[model samples]
Structure formats: structure tokens, C-alpha cells
Target chain A: MQAQTQRYSVLMVDDDPEDGVLVQKAIASSGPKVDFQFVASGAEVLDYLFTEGRFTDRSSAPRPNLILLDLNMPGVDGFSVLKQIKSDMDLRRIPVVVLTTSEAETDIVKSYDFGANTFITKPSSFSDMIEVMTSLKSYWFDAARLPTA
Target chain B: MLAIYEYLFGAASFVPHGYCLAWRPDLIAIHALSDGVIALSYFSIPIALILLLNKREDLAFKRTFGLFALFIFSCGVTHLTAMIMLWEPYYGAQGMVKAVTAMISVVTAISLWPLLPKVLALPGPGQLRKMNTQLAAEIAEKNAAQVNLHQAYQQVEAQVVERTRELQALNQRLQDDVRRRSLLEEELREKAAQLIATNAELERFAYIASHDLQEPLRKIQAFGDLLKSEYETVLPDEAVEYVRIMQNAAYRMNKQTKDILTLSRLSWDSIQFDSLDLAEVVEEVAFDLKERIEEAGGKLEVGPLPGIPGDRTQIRLLMQNLLVNAFKYREPDSIPEVHVEATLHDTGAPGTGGACVEISVRDNGIGFAQEDAERIFSIFQRLHGRSEFDGTGIGLAICKKIVENHNGAIEAVSSLGKGAVFNIRLPTSQPERREIHAGTDTAV
Candidate 1:
């Protein structure tokens, strides 16, 4: 995979720590090259991206090339994060894929309207999650062009 | 004694007056005729005066007229004595009569002096005529004023009648308005009752959806999948079966939670009504289920459908659910064949009369008994065993709710061997275009 030569880090934002672990496993099953990172809340996403608060270490907290966002969080929801990311010049280039358990039309449309690159319903099965991650990996890392870091 | 008697009787000592005239026949005759005519006129005048006095008893000074008549009678006796002396002297009797006439004339003259002023004070005929003319003019004016007053009374009467009629009309209109408002109020009361009952049901659904159950259920399914995928090589066959069972149970529970959320959303959110082409909706659903249909070797024939007023998302879901049911409940051997068709029909709903589109979805599937047709639309109601068919059993219930939100009707008909048919009726046009907000005020 091209991720071996160019290490790509993906950040996932969710309030549920278990969903973060499951997604990390799925990413591992998809490929060995891609690095997976996690944040527990939407507010922590900004901290990790801007190197603020607990994420002040420059070397430890790197800018992610992609962001996986969950819509139903306690505070600073996915929509507000998407809006802030899309509005910022430095963060707008990072592709955001909304992976939430909501299959609501309003959520999907709102996610896309807020400049989400993709909207995916979180699958229940581990195999389905692996399939989603594999396709996402092949599409974003292999097929699609991205801004050079 | 003889002298005294001759003075009283007169004519005994005197020769006749005819002798003094040398017995001239012409002179005698003239004196006698003149005196006789004068006496006759005086007597007739007294009689006429008496008759006048008797007829006019109301005349002023009646005693004066009687005295004047007596004086004239005495003068007539004197004249008769003159006529008698033309032949034989009657001088004594004439003197006595003259004395009586004098007395009566004096009395009449005295009475006339006082009565003259009273007779002059009486109104004359010309002045009375002028007064009568003035009285006639005043009476005419009074009559004209009476006529005007009568006309005014008539006008007032007409106005009263007109006002009464107007009030009656206004009262009738008010009565009609009251009846209409009462009917509307009755309908609102019924709707409020239904809302109360529906709100109670929605509360339960909301509780289930918001219970944080799906998260744990999803984790269970995902961990179960992970065990099978990662630890299958080390696990025994029995452990593998146990993992599979746990995954199936979790998957079913996850589906139930998702279905509950869908039901709660229907009761929590305001649905948007729009003009929707149902044929296009069916095409989209068929395209979405294309793989399933091809895998089953099924045929979905869509006939001409109608455009109806409904919530687009809900109507799309309705079509998807019905078609998915047809594909899901198919017999094992038979090729799944589903026909989608529509017809224009009248809803004939009271106060909501309009045309509706009747869409039927007939599927060659494992049909349920006729009795379970109505029960299938209930929430979480399932006729077949969970092992036989894969469903959370809320699809038909959602369909029924969607139809109700559109103010439409939906029904299902099926027998044991025969195929099942789902008929949905949607109004072509909404009556009295008011925005409808279904469910509770709070969003789930």
C-alpha cells in the first residue's frame, strides 16, 4: 500500500470509546500501513487538530489527512466540527467522512451540506465495518488524489 | 139723567154727519170707503204682527211688539167710527178708542228706546260670512296636517317591518354560524382526543428509542462478529454456534431498536407535505432493491401510477417497505413476482371529498391467514416465526402511520395459499390546504 511510504493518519471523533476501538480494529484489518487515532469527544477533535489543551505536544499530535466524525456527541457535535473545519483554510482540505449510527435523511443531507466528503451509516457487523474501511482505504489512499503534505 | 146718557152713548142728540154734507153721495162714499180700507189694513197688520210674534218667540222685546199691535187696533176702531159717522155719528166710541191707542203707543215707544242698541250690537250677515270663510280655511289646514301625520305613521310602520325582517335575517345567519362553529369545535375535540391517545403511544416509543439500548446491542453484534472473524480458528464448533446465536440475537435486537426509532421519529417530527410522483418513488425503491430482486429472480411490474400530495420521504419509505415485504415473504420455490398499479378513485370522505389514487402492491408470497391481515398493521406485530422470515415487524405499522399522516387509508388482504395484496389510498389533492404537524411537540 502507498500508506507505507507516506504514513497517513486518520482521526476519528466519537463520544463512545468502544466505537473508536471497533473502528481502529476495522482500519487494522483494512491495511497495516494506515495509522489510526481516536478522540473521545467533538471538542477534543479541535484540541487534537490545533494542538491545544491536552494535545499540546507537537510531535505526538499530528494533523490528520482524514477525519471520521460521529454526529451524536455530548457537545460540539459533528455538524459544528464539520462547519469549523470546512471554513478554516488549513483544515478544509482534510476529507471528512461522517460515520454515524443515524440513518436519518436530515443527518445525511446536513452532513453533505456542511461539506462532508462522505456519509456512511455505522454497520453493526465487524465484517461490514472491515469492508467499509477497506473500500474507504482503497478509494481515499489508492484511487483519489489528495493535497500533498 | 138723559143728558148724561147721551154723552155716554153719543149719536142721540146729534144729526147724522150725512146731513151736514147736504147728502152729497160722492163725498159720503169717499169718506166711508177710505175709513173702511184703513181699518181693514190696521186690523190685518195687528194680526200679522201677532203671528210674527208667535213664530219668533225668541225675538228681543216681545212685549213692545204686543203693545204696538194693540195701538194699531185702537187706531182701526177710530177709523171704523169715522166710516160709521159717514152714515150715523159714533164720536164717543171713537174718543174712547183713541185714548186706549195713545196709552199703548207711549208704552211701545218707551220699550223701543232701550232695545235699539241691542239690535245694533248683533253681528251682520257679511261679517258672519267672513268669519265662516276663515273657520273653513283653518279646518282645511288641520285636515292636511292630519294627512301628513298619517303618512309619517305609515312610514314608521314600514321601517319597523323592514328592521324586523333584517334582524330576523341576521339572527338566521348567526344561527348558521353557531352551528358551523359547533361542528368545527366538535371535530377539534375529537382530534384532541386522538392526539392525546397518540401522544401516549409516542411517549413509549420515545422511551424505547432514547434508552441507549442500540449502542450496547451494536457492540454485542460487532464483538460477536469479531469473535467469529478472529477467533474462529481456535474456537470449538459449539462455541462457534454460540457466537452465531449471540450475533443473531443482537442483530435482531438492533433491528428492533432501529425500527422503534423510526416509529418514534414519525411521531416526533413534523412531516413535510409535497407533490410527489408515486411512480418515481416506486422506481427509486425498485432500483434500491435491484440486487435482492435479481438474486431472487423476481419480476416487479410497475403500471401507471398517479401523482399525489404527501410527504415525499415518508411515501418513499412506504413504497420501499411494501416492496421489501413482497421480496422478503416469498415462497421458497416460486419466483417472486410483484405488481405495482394505481387507479383513480373517490375518497368519499365526509367534509373531505376529493379524488384519491389507489395503489395496489400484489406479491406472490407466503401469504398469511385472512384474520391476521388487520393485525399485521399493528406495531411489532408479526404472524410468521422469526426463524421463518427476517423482519422486526414494524414495516406495515409504519406504512399505516404514513398513510394516516397523509389523511389517507391503507389495507392488506391475504389468504393461506393465495398471494398478499397491499392497497394504499392517497388523496390527489389536500382539502383546505393547512400544514399538518403530526406527533408530539418534542423531537425524539
Candidate 2:
């Protein structure tokens, strides 16, 4: 749930630094209070989500309200991460958005099949990316209702 | 009896024939001359008979002729005896000669009587001549028949020789046909092997294009976009322009790789065909391109279309590329007008011909040169520079591949400066799907 005083959190898992930074900038531009977090690999995302390994301290690993996932990763790919998150009762309630460079139909269908809330192909232009971020923020933060964390 | 025997042997009757004529000179002379002439005549007749018998030795009655000769000689001896009797009265000798002649005459008569029927049975000269003529006629007829038989045999031999020659020629042609067919089979086998190798290579290329090649290009574009969006104010106008150019290059490369990937995928992907209304497909394509069309101030007119069997996604891409190409190549300061229409050609009444739908995409845009119609449907074949028309030059090639994927044909007809028409012929029914050999596992 969105509250005026509490800042919402978002987590993105991507292997590419360039894509991560661009999405970070877009998220920053879209919302001032959004706590956007970046994990470089699927393993790190799992670590951060379960509060294990380097993120073992409960205070350091804040549970995210939404997850932005990239399907192609070096090890423990986004599909496996998505499957694990959706199957876990504690993590299943969190919304997942699949964002990837691939515009392949198979990827889109598979992402939805794995219980992803939305699928977005990564826009090439900064302006288009900003638009996607703005609309995502408006829909998730302002229009649609979510269960309280 | 003793006195008679003595009288027969003794010369007591020895007397001259002249004394018997009473010693007259004229009478004696006449008797002697007549007897001498008669004797000479009788000897000459026997000699002539002997000569006749010797000359005609093949005569049928040779024994009869010998008997006749003997009888004549004996009679001659008797006549000579008479002549002697006229000179010297040797009556006993004369009687003996007459007796021998009488005996020979009696034997000749007996032999002649038995030979009479045989001599009568011998053919006459006229009958012999008639038989010779008949034999000659029969011989002539047999000779003519023999000649005819020989000619017929020759004609049959000639025909056999001719038929043998014809059979030999037919065998030669059949052997040549077999050899040609074997050569064709060998060529086909080699082509099949080459196709396998080429398909493998295409699959490798598609994997590289889809993932590895697009990766760095995407990064380059993303960073360039960031620089332009975030640091444009701090950067000089020239720097900003450089960034924009770099992004544009990266974008174009990405698009080119994507198109290459699509073309490669079309080659090896398994297609599942569905019964689709082509009108609905075209309408969907038009709706997706609505904003672009409105931006170009274009008008799209769709006519009635038939249902055909095709891959839905591929067909959608095919229509999208065609419409975009029509609008992209439009003349400056003119509204882009694209028309989509289809006509059914039910040629399946004859089983050899397939019923098909001929869909034509006509555009009132800047058409290409007539000679370049075939070249336009080849990948990366650009008709204009990038600045003149923003294109990767793979749209028509993709269209061609899509049409071919549906087991169809496509052709473009146009003149320079005239509107172009792209005619696509698609069968109403899909052909049986052939199983393609899977590529290497490493390929994406």
C-alpha cells in the first residue's frame, strides 16, 4: 500500500550496468520518494529478497513493493527467480514487472505465464523510457490499489 | 543209203553252168554277167546293213539288227554259190549254201515274231515330241516358282535387317535416358548436401545476430541516449550532435541485425498455418500503423479479401512491412495512398493448378525503376540513401520470405515515376508440412 509519509521501494535485477543506470535515472525522474534498488545478477536478487548472504541483516534488506526483472542473465536467470518468487507464499503477493531488451513474443508469453504482472520491452530512446517509467509510477502508485506490506 | 551218202560227198556232178546253157556264146555271157552282178549286189547290201548297225549302236533292237545282218550274209553266200554253180556245176556245195541260208532265215523269223510286240510298244516320233514339250512347260513353271520363293526370302531378310536396326536405335535412346536421369540424381544429392550445410550456417548467423550482436549495440545506444538526455546542457552543441549521430548509428545497426535475425528465422522456423481472413489481418496491420499513416497524412483503402492458410504472426509482419514501405517511399508533398485488394483465382478445377488468392498492394507513392523490381526483393538492396529514406532495405525481402513461407509467389510491376503494384499469390490451402532437420543445440 502507498502512504504519503512512507517511501515505496522498487528492486530491479539486470546484468547490464548501462541498462541499470538508465532505468535508475528514469525511476529517479519519475518519483522523488521511490527507493529504487539494483542487483547485478539473479543470485544477488535472490540474496536481497530472502535477506541472506550479504543482505542477511533485516534492516539492510528492505522488502520491495515491486520487482523489475530482466529475463536474460548470466546465472540463475530471471525466469528461475520469477518462478521461485511466485511459488514462495511470502513473496508471491509482491508485483513483478518483466523488463528486457528482447521483444521476442516467446519471452513476453513466458513472462506472463510465470505470473509476471506486466511485460515491457526496454525502449531505445531516453524520452520513451521516461514515458514508460512515468506511466508505471502513475498506474502502480496513484491509480491501482495494492495490499499493505 | 551208202550210194546216196557217196553221191552227196563225191564231185560226180561237177559241170560248168555254160554247158548247161548248150555252149551258146551269148547265153553263157548273159548268165555269167547276171550271176556276178547279183553276187556283188548281195555282198554290198550286207556291208551296208553292218555299217548301219555299227553307226546306230544305242538302237533299242541291237540283237534284232545282229540277227538281220547274219541272215543277209548267209543269203549273200548262197547267191555267190549260185554264181559258182554257173561256172563249174558244183551242185552239192550250192545245195549246202542254200541249206545254211534256209536255216538262218528260219531262226530270224522265229526271233522276229517274239520282238514284234516290243517293237510296236516303242513310242512314235510324234508322241515323243509331245512328251518333250510337256516336260519343258513343267520345268519352266518350277523355275518361275523357285525364283519367286527366292525373292520372298530376300524381302523377309531385308525386313529383319531393318527391324534389327530400329530396335538398336531404341535401345540406344533408352540407355541415354537412363544415363541422363542418373546424372540428374547425382546433382540433386549434391544440392541436398549443400543445403544442409547452408542451413546450419544460417542458424549460427541468426543466433549471433539476435543476442551477441544486438547486445553491444543496445548498450551503445542506451549510453548515448543517457548522455544526450542527462548531459546535453553541459556538453557543447557539437558534442550533443556527435552523441545523436552515435545513437542513430547504433539504432540503425540494431534494426539491421533484427531484420537479419527475422530473415534467418524465417528460413528455419517451423510454421503452423491457420485459416485466416486476410481482410481482418490487413485491417489489424492498418490499425497498428494508424499513427504513422496519420503522421504522413496517408490514406489506406482495403478491398474484399479471401481466407487463406498462413502463419498468423508472419502474415501480420508481412502486411506491416509492405504498408510501411509504401508510405516510406512516398513522393515529397504528396499524400501516401495505399490500397489493398484481393482476387480469387479458382484454378483448382484442373487438379494440376491450385486455387489461390491474388492479393495486390498498390501504392500511389514514388515507385522504383522498372528494372529494379526484382532487385528490390533482395535483402539489404537499398534503392536510396539513408538520408533520403530511412530504411534498412530488408522490408521487401522479409515480405518475399513470408510469402514464400506460405508457399506463395510475389511479383512487383511498375514503371518509373508510376505507382507500384505488389501482387502476392497465396494458395487457399496449406501444403503438407515438411519436417526440417533441427540445427545444433548451441544455436538459439
Candidate 3:
């Protein structure tokens, strides 16, 4: 209910730095007054999510309303992280979205199977990503009422 | 009495000695028989013609006409020879009669000459009549064709009128349609745009999902590790077992998810086509898997491989997977022996036939039930226990997909406890084949 008035915090984890920056640009361009956090790998997400190790300070590490993940990573990949996040009672309440460079059907099915709330392939061009983020703002921010757990 | 007796004796004694039908002495009888023979000889031409002309396809007129000509000529020969033989007859043997018969035959032979010209002439009576009939038929056909054309023209005129009206209506509709089409095209373009966007969106979603999911997966793996490492001491045996099982499942899922991503990427990724020597590829794979093969105490045998248009990196991966399977599924207490052979097989039409290279990899592995042969090519379909043989269960399926990308097929032949041989076929042709066809055609 609080998300109805207040802007939601988005936590995006991607191995590619350019992409992470691109997503940030897209969110900003959409004119949404939102908090954005970027983590390089899936391992960092755990520290951030559970408030453990480097993410011990809760104020600096805000509770994210949404999480975007990339399936491919060097160590402790995306699907494994998704399963664990969805399995936990506390973490399961937050909406998780999957982002990839491929429109592969298997990833879509698998991501959802692991309890991903939404799936989106990262657009190639800057403009397309901006457009998608604009529509996403229309849908997630305006159209649909997200669950409060 | 004496005169009557002399007349009777003279009449009785007038018959020539040894005069019989076999040696005919009577000129009238002989002449009559000669006339009959001449008549029959003359009729043979028509008889041969009748025989030949009975069936439509039996024989043509030219052959029968030729036979008729021969019959006339043969009859002339028969008559002339008969006249020469009959020159000195007993009862009515006369030179004049022979001369007359010879003359008739010579005249008849002359008649045969004109008949031949008539026979061999380009157009006979029948042919001329046939020509007339054909001309009439052709004229009728042409008239029919003209009528059809006229009807068609009338129909076309009607159609044009209707179509013109349709065009006017269509012109109005077309304007609407053009706008609609533009709108539809735009809608399609938008739909395509959205689909593509959604596709990209989906990919991003997967990436994000994978990225986000990894965090929790790592935590599961890590916490499972943490629990095992830190909390295993005080926990109950059942709890420890549950933690271990959880970790096992989590790790298994992690590996499997990663493998599934990899396998699916094989389709999504672009395949590079280059001339790859399969022998060289196999050798490289064999070298890479040398340690594994040696550990399994297995031997790798290779064959004369055909060079093909293929992706070298992918092919190397293909060979690696096959060899790995060979090494992984070896018989109990036996060294692994894997043989990789490639040979060209002929297929299709004539000298310009295409070539298919059959690459077979045989291994003395723990063979499967034959029914499971096809099942092995399915994703996540495993024949053996994870303890007995460890795999992502997508190795063969990936191999099949890779082989199929090259327009090839893969088949497995094996029996339980014996061994397994995997056969892969790729339809490949030589680059120089175009040159050969071009050269031969040029020579001709």
C-alpha cells in the first residue's frame, strides 16, 4: 500500500557494467524518482539481500521492491540465486525480474519456474531500452498494483 | 470293220507314252494350271496387303505396298520361267503360246513399275483423303479455338466491366484499405516492434532473473555450506542429512540450470561455417580428453576424416562431448576404447551426386537398452544412475542438435553391457563440384 504513493526501489544485478549503466539511464530517463542499486555479480546480491557481510548497514542497503537478474555469471549464477531467494519466506515476497540478452524460450520458462515475477531481455540499442523502461513505468508504476507482503 | 478297227486303234494309240499329271503332256491343262498360278501370284500382293493392314498398329501401308510390288515382280519371274519350260510341249506345245505368256508377264512387270510409283508417292489416295480429313479437323479445331477465344474475349470484356466497377469500389476500398493497410502495417510493425521488444524484454528478464536468482542460489549453496561448516557440530544427524540433501539439490540445480542455458544457446547462437578437417578436430578433442581417456584406461581410435563445411569450434565441442561420454560410460574393470571414423557415402542422382560423411564413434561403455537409444538424445533424459555415470543428461541431445544444424543425422546402436556406437551423418558436397559441371557443360 505504501508503494502506491512512494516510488519503489529497484535492485539490478548484472555482470556487464555497460548494461547496468544502461538500465540506470533508462530508469532515469523515464522520469521515475526511484532509488537504484547496482551489484556486479550474484554473490553480492546475497550480501545485499540478507544484510550480511558488506551489506550490514540497512539504511545504505534499502529494501528493494524489485530485483532484476542476469542468468549468466562467473560464480554462483542467476537461477541458483533465484531458487534460494524464492524459497525463503522473507525474500519470496519481493518481485524478481529476469533480464538477459537472449530471447531464448527456455530461460523464460526456467526463470518463471524459479519464481521470477517478470522476464525481459535487455534491448540492444539505448533508445529501445528507454522505450521499454518507459512502458514498464506505465505498467508497474501506474497500471498494476504490486502486492504488499 | 477294218477301217473302224483302224480308227479305234488310232484313237486308242494316240495317247503319248508316260504322259501323266506329274509330267503333263496336255497343253490346255498345263496352260489352265499356269493361268491359275498366275492369278494366285497376282492376288498374293492384295493378300499380303490385307494381312498387313488389318490392325491399325500392325503394319504401315509402305511395307505392305513394298510386299505387293515384290509379289508382282515374283509373279513375272514365275510366268517367264514357266513359258521357257513349256516351249516344247507334246500335245499342244507351241512357241507362240509361250511367247504370248512371256509377253503378258513382261507387260505385267511393266505395270508393277507404275504401281510402285503410286505406292511410293508421298501422297496416296488414302493419304490424300487423310490429309483432307486432317485439314478439316484442323480447321474445325481452329474454329473451336477461335470460338473459345471469342467466348473468352466476351467473358474478358464482361469481366473488365465488372472489374472496372470492382476497381471503382476497390478504389474507394483501396483508399480505406491503404489507410487500413498502413494502419495494419503500422500495427504489424508495432506488433513486431512490441514482439521484438518483448523478446528483448524477455532476454533482459532472463538476464535479470539469472542475475537475481544467482544471488539466492549462492546463498542456498553458501548457507548450506555455512550450516554444514558452522552448525553441523551441534545439529542432529537428521538435520545434518537434510542440510546435505538441500545442498546437493541446490548444487545440482545450479549446475543443471547453467547446463540448460548452455544447451539452449547452441540454437540461439550463430554457427560459423568453415572448411574443417574432422580428423584434425577429433585429434584435438582426443588430446584434450587424453587425461580422462587415460584415467579410464581407454584407447581412442580415429579414422580418415572427411573435410566439410562446419564450425571448427562447435565440431571440436561435439567430438569432446562424444569422447567424454565414451570415457565416462566404460564397462566395469575394462579400459575404455573409443573409435571415431569418418567416411564419405554416395547419395542421389548420377555423376553429380551429393556426398554424406558418416562419422561413427564407438565406445566400450556401459551400453543401454536399445529402446533408450533414442531417449538418450532427449534433454535431461538419462539412462544410467548419477552415481554410475555423471552427466548433465543433455550431452547427446546437444550433440544431436549440433549435428542437425549441419543438415546431418545421428543414430545410436548398442546393447546392454556390451558397448555403444554412435553414428553421425552429414550431407556435405565438394566445393569443386560446380566447376566439374561447368567444365563438362562447356566441353559439350
Which candidate leads the pack in TM-score? 1
Write candidate 3's Cα lDDT for A1-149 as tens digits: 12457868889898877677777877887766778999988899988999888899998789888888888777878888899899998999887888875455677888899899888876534556678778776676677777754
Look at candidate 1 and give me any clashing residue pairs: none
Considering summed lDDT, which 10 consecutive residues are worst modelled in model 3 chain B? B435-444
Q: Per-residue lDDT of A1-149 in model 1, one digit per residue for the tens?
A: 34445878899999889889899989998865687889989899988888999999977788898899998788798888999999999999999999987766667888899999999988888989999999998888877878886
User: How do the predictions measure up, each by TM-score?
Assistant: 0.65, 0.64, 0.42
Q: Write the per-residue lDDT of candidate 1 for residues B1-444, one digit (tens) a residue.
A: 876556646786777777788879998888888899999999998899999999998987677788888888888887888788777766665566677777777887888898889878876788889888888998999999999999999999999999999999999999999999999999999998788778767765564464457767889989888888889999999999999998889878877877777776775567777788888999999999999999998999999987888788889999999999998897777899999999987754223667778889999888889899899999989888888888998988999988887788888999986889998877777644343334442212
Error of 3 at B6 (Å): 99
The predicted structure with the larger TM-score, 1 or 3, is 1
User: Model 1 segments beyond 4 Å from truth?
Assistant: A1-4, A75-89, A104-116, B1-211, B346-354, B432-434, B438-444
Candidates ranked, most accurate by DockQ first: 1, 2, 3
Please state the CAPRI-style docking class of candidate 2: incorrect
Give candidate 2's fnat, 2 decimals: 0.32
Q: In model 1, what is the error at residue B408, expressed in angstroms?
A: 2.7
Identify the runs in model 3 with alpha carbons over 4 angstroms from their true place: A1-149, B1-202, B205-210, B226-243, B348-353, B429-444
Q: How displaced is residue B239 in candidate 3, in Å?
A: 5.7
